[model samples]
Target: MCDEKQLQTWAKDTLSRREFGAFSGAAALAACTPGEANGTDANTSEASGDVTESSVSFETEDGTMDAFFVHPSGGPSPAVIFWPDIASIREAKRNMARRLAGEGYAVLVVNPYYRDVAGEQFADFAAWIAADGFDAESGFALVAPWREKLDADAIGRDTAAIVEWLDGQDAVDTSRGVGAEGYCMGGPFTVWSTAAVPERVKAAASFHGGGLVRGDDPKSPHNMLDQAQAEYLIAVAQDDDAAAPDDKAAFAEAAEAAGRPAVVEVYEGDHGWTVPDSPAYAQAAAEKAFADKLELYARAL
Candidate 1:
C-alpha cells in the first residue's frame, strides 16, 4: 500500500518537469492549427490503403470540444472514441488514433478538458498538476474550478455528441456499434459515457481509471454503473489497488451481480504505465495491456 507521502513522491518523479514542458509545447501547436473541415473527405482519401487525419469540434454541456479524428480513406468503418489522460491530447494519443485508423477503424480522440481550454491545453494543465503533485486531492483541486465550468455531466453529453457526430460521418459505420477507451481520469469518463448511452457503445475499456468506485458519496459517478450495458474491461495498476481495494472489488461484484460482461486485469506497473509521456511508463506492461485492449475491442466491438 502506498501512503500519501509515498504516492506524492512517486507522482512527482513520475510526472517529470522536462517531459511536461515538451508536451505543453506540442499542445500549443495543435491548438493553434486549424483542423480539417470535412471528416469524410479525410477518411475517403485514406480508404485507398492510405491514412487520413482531420480535426473537428462539437458542442458539449460545458462548451465546444475539439478532437482529432482519423481513419482509412474509403467508406464507413468501425468507430472507436478514445478519451485521453489528464495530460490532455498529446502526440501519443494522436499516434494511437492513426494506428487504429490504419487497422481499418475510424477513430475519434476527444479532448476531455475541452471546456477548460480551446485546443490542446496541456502546458497549463501540466503546470497545475506538477504543483499539486498529481494525487487525487490535487486532481480534484485542479479540476474543481472547472467543475462549474465543465461539470461532470459534460462527460456523458460530450461523448454522446462525439458518437453522434461520428455516426454521421461517411467514414463511420453507424449500423455497427462503437467502442470507447480511456486512460486515467478519462477512463472513468469513458465508463460514464458508455453507461449514459448504453445503446450506442458496445465495448468500454478503462486503463488505470480513478473513481471506478466511490470512497465517500453514495451518489457518485461510480454509482452510475447500474445503467451500463456495454462489456467492460478495466486495467488497474498494482499501486492503485492499494488505495482502493474495496472499491475495485465492489465494482467487479456489481458487474457480476448485474450479469454484465466485465473483467479486471492488474498490470505489474505504476499508475501511468500506459501513458508514454509519463515517467512511470513501462513499455513491456503497456504493450501487453494495449494488446489486451485491442483484443477486447475486437471481440466486443
Candidate 2:
C-alpha cells in the first residue's frame, strides 16, 4: 500500500484538463448550483427549498471550528459529519452538504485545516492545485503545515469534539446514531470517527480518499476497523486503485475479521470525481457513490 503522505501528495498534484462543465471556468457558479448538469440525477431526494442551511461554529480543543450545517426543516434527522478534501471547506462542499441533508441527514461539513486557518482556504480544489503554479511556486507551501497536523492522533481528538457537539444538537436525532464521510485526505477521518466514538458513529463513508491502507503505519485506518462499530463504504479512485490494488482486499479482510460490514470498490473516476466543482468530476460515478452512501446510512444509521 502507498504511504499516507505519498498518497496525499499524489492527490495534491492530480490535475486534468478534461472538459468538466462545473470546473471549466464556472466553479463559483457550480458551487451554488449542484446537480444541475445531470438534472438532479437519481440520487437527490428532495427539493433544495426543503433544506434548512446555516453557517455554524463550535468550540473544539484546537479552537473554534466553523462549519456548514444543513438539514431538512421537519425535525431531528440522522447526522453526518463531513470532512472536506485538501482544499478545506468551500462553497462546493456546502452545496454537497445541503444536498446530503435534503436526503434526511443533518450534515456538518467541517474545515479540516481550521487548525491553521478558518474559512475557505481556496476558491475550490482547482484553485488550490493551481496555487503556486501547481507546486513550482506555492502549492505545497500552503498545505504542508496543515497536512502535518492531521495524523491519526489529531484526527481522533477532533472526531471526539465533533461527535460531542453533534450529540447535543437539536437537529440531530441521537437515537439514530451518526454517519461520517470524507473525501481525499479526509477519507481516513471516517474510519477515525468510528474509533473515536464507537457507539455514536454507526456508519462511515470514504470517497476517492487517500491513505486508507498503509503497510508502514501502525495506526492505518484499516488497522482501527476493529475499534469502530460502524459499517463502512470505501470508494477508491481509479488511479488510486492502480497504485495500490492490495489496499482494498486488505481492508475487506480486516473488516470481515472485525465483523464489520464494509463495501470496498473502485469507482469509475479520478480522485476528485465526487465534488461538483472538481475538474475530475464524473457525474455518473459520483451519483453511484452518493447512492451508496445514502444506502449505507439508510441501513446503518
Candidate 3:
C-alpha cells in the first residue's frame, strides 16, 4: 500500500553535499523571489492571481504573534496553519503559502519564534547556517536557546491560540475542517496541533521533521498520537531515516494504536529536502511529498 495509500520516494540521492548546496543555492535564489516560485503562476492558474496576502498579528498568551496569511479572493476556504522550519518565516514561506492559497485553501505561515523575535531572523536556510559559523556546533549554538523556549507543551498552547484566531477569520471555512503542515522542527508541531485542537484540525502533514520519536523523550510526539482526531501524512527524509531506522515503524504502530489513518513513507532525500530554500532540496522527492500533501488535504479537509 506504500505505492497506493502511501506515497513513494521519487529518486535516489545522487548529489553530494557540495553538489547539492551549489544546485540549491542557484535554484533557491530564483525560487525564493516573490511571485516566481509559485506553483500556480498568474499565467498558469487564474486562482494564482486571485490570492490576497497580508501580514497579520494577534494576541497569544505569550505575546503579540505575527504571521503571513494568504487565501483566494473567494470567501471561506478550509484553513491550514503552516509552521515553518528552523529558519522561520521568510520570502520562501510567504511564496509557499501563496501557492497553497491558489490551490483553494486559506494558508497562514507562522513565525514560530515569536517570543524572542518578531520577524525574519535569517534571509534563508543558508543564511541561518552561515550566521552561526556553518558547523554543527556553531549552528546548534544559535538555535539551542531559541529551541529551548518552544518545548512541546509551549507548542501545544501556541497551536490552540493559532486555531482560535484562524476560526475567527472571514477567509476561513469553519464549517469544513482545518489542516496543519509543518517542516523540520515544525514537523512535530503538526502532531501537537492535532492533539491541541483535534476537533478542528482534521488533517496534518509532517515533512523531514526532527525528533518525532525520540527514545529518550518519554513525551515524544509519537506518544501523543491517540490525542489527535486527524489523519496523518508523515514523510521522512532518507538521511533522517538512516539515523533512526526505527522511527517509521514506531510512528506507524502508534497511528494504528490511535486508530487514525496515515501514510508514513521514507523518501529518497536528505533532511530539509521538501523546503526549496534548503541546501538539501531534492526536487523529485519534494514534488512527490507535495503531491501526497495535496491528496491528503483533498480527502481530509
Among all windows of 10 consecutive residues in model 2, the one with the lowest summed lDDT is: 36-45
- Per-residue alpha-carbon lDDT of candidate 3 for residues 1-301, written as tens digits (9 for 90 to 100): 0110011111113444354446545766554435534432222223445777777889898887888888888688999999998778876777777778878899988888898888778766655654554443444467668778887788888888999999999989999889999998889889888988889999999998877886656568888888889999999988778777888999899899989998999998888778777766777888789889999999999
Error of 3 at 250 (Å): 0.5
Prediction 1 TM-score vs. true = 0.79
Q: Which stretches of candidate 2 lie over 4 Å from their true place?
A: 1-48, 134-137
> Cα deviation in Å at residue 132, candidate 2?
2.6
On TM-score, the stronger of 1 and 2 is: 2
User: lDDT: which is higher, 2 or 3?
Assistant: 2
Q: Residues 123-170, candidate 2, lDDT per residue (tens digit)?
A: 666567556654433655788898899988888888888889888889
True-vs-predicted CA distance for residue 209, candidate 2, Å: 1.1
From the highest TM-score down, the ranking of the candidates is 2, 3, 1
Q: State which candidate has the highest lDDT.
A: 2
The Cα error of candidate 1 at residue 48, in Å, is 11
Estimate the overall C-alpha local distance difference test score of candidate 3.
0.77
Ten residues in a row with the worst lDDT in model 1?
Answer: 36-45
Q: Where does candidate 1 clash, by residue pair?
A: 43-73, 46-73, 47-72, 47-73, 47-74
Over 61-137, each residue of candidate 1 has an lDDT whose tens digit, in order, gives 55787888888887678899998876666566666576667667888988776766655554344554565665435
Model 3's number of clashes is 0
